[model samples]
Target: MDYMTLKEASEKWGISSRQVNYYCVEGRIPGAVKIAGVWLIPKDAEKPIDGRRKNIL
Candidate 1:
């Protein structure tokens, strides 16, 4: 399977790296693993829905 870095995921998801990290920490991102202080997200992983958003599908 292919993997993408936090920065790449952030850019792809149109969010901040910090938010990606937070998602990883919260287990919001499926198949996201942390190695050597770096986050590796699956290339095909879908962006998790934001709880802060109202009625966002």
Candidate 2:
């Protein structure tokens, strides 16, 4: 299982690094694990939708 750091995930997801951390902290991101105080997100993990933003369809 290939894992990426928060910084890499943030860049790939086109969101702020802090936001990625927030998702990890909230358990919104699946397959996310914390090791040595560092969050390692799966490279293939889908980006979580922002609940704070309204989805106008």
- What would the C-alpha RMSD of candidate 1 be, to one decimal place? 1.9
Q: At residue 7, what lDDT does model 1 achieve?
A: 93
lDDT of 1: 0.94
For residue 33, model 2's alpha carbon misses the true position, in angstroms, by 0.4
Give per-residue CA lDDT, model 2, range 1-57, as digits (tens): 999999999999999999999999999999999999999999999999899899789
- The true-versus-predicted C-alpha distance at residue 12 of model 2, in Å, is 0.2
lDDT of each: 0.94, 0.97
Q: All candidates: CA RMSD in angstroms?
A: 1.9, 0.8
- Write the residue-wise lDDT of candidate 1 on 1-57 in tens digits: 899999999999999999999999999999999899889999999999988879848
Q: Which regions of candidate 1 are displaced past 4 Å?
A: none
TM-score of each: 0.91, 0.94
Clashes of each: 0, 0
Candidate 2 lDDT: 0.97
